[model samples]
Target: MDATVFEQIRLMLWDVDGVLTNGDIFISAEGESFKQFNVKDGVAVALLAKHGVKTGVLSGKQSPALSKRCEQLGLDIVMTGIHNKIAALSAICKELSITPKQVAYIGDDVIDLEVMRHVALTFAPADAHMLIKNEADVVTQASGGRGVAREAAEHLLMSRGLSMDEVYKPLMDAWNATVVVQ
Candidate 1:
């Protein structure tokens, strides 16, 4: 993968179950199910958005937990419970006024193939399905539910001649702006 590939990305989308998590569903003894997410991914999402890169998630499964996390990160697009990922991707591109060539995707399973084919770049986690890894533009060293998103963001920022501290500067400024001067 080259910097040119990452340089074209104006919007980056994700697959939740495997890309954002480890693809394991935790079911409690009382029948409650939960998902655990990496905090590093959350930071990447926020900082990327702050750095002017749009972010989204497209998942086949609907999850309140995912929804809450997206709210906290303020992602630009979130389409869950989707069966036709290509259609969703097309619609989202149209809505965002960006072409597929301006989008980069990260996914980890067979279900993500359709959308993956249409994007400018595709990233796969280290532990992704064989097919996904085989087809990905880049196979990250970090596995899913780890720092995959951070790696992706770092690559993109590097392409743009930027740094993590640069991405986070806006946030630090915002924090300092709101602090009381006591």
Candidate 2:
């Protein structure tokens, strides 16, 4: 809960289903599962990447859509079909040459508790299970599949004495430079 914890975050990890899809699984006649992701959340990941933060996905269930989304987001540290998230998280930390304290975890269900507890900062969606929310360091106002990721990004930047303006300033400047009067 301390602001300093957020300030120390360098990697952001997320659990899929509930945190990214409102916990809904749609299976078509061919048994293909589909999940909807929010564009705002994708932009939030882009913002974090812009600020030199690493992002990853750790999920309990296996879904093709999740992998596609991770690929599209340029997130390389992905682990799916995970029943033991803590071990996966540890392995990811080891691979990244960082400790758990450098990671911020966001979740919405019970399976995420162990990894969430081990990370430097923990966030839960507003509609997360009550028990999980109780254990989270921060609970986003936006529900899953909404703007929860964006909310977390803003909070992380603020905690570190940074701003969205700082994150977007370079691109804005580039755009302005390339503009010409017609």
Cα RMSD, each candidate:
3.7, 4.3
**Local error of candidate 1 at 20, Å?**
0.7
- Kindly list the per-residue Cα lDDT of model 1 for residues 67-136, writing each as its tens digit: 7877876788999989999999999999989899999999999998888899999999999999999989
Give one digit per residue, the lDDT tens place, for model 2 in 1-182: 67777767889988888787788888898664778888777767766766678888899888788788888877758899998999999899999999999998899988888888898888999999988899988899999988787788878877787677886665355555542111
Q: Model 2: how far is 110 from its true place, Å?
A: 0.8
Residue-level lDDT for 36 in candidate 1: 78
- Candidate 1: Cα lDDT at 31: 45
**Whole-model lDDT per candidate:** 0.83, 0.82
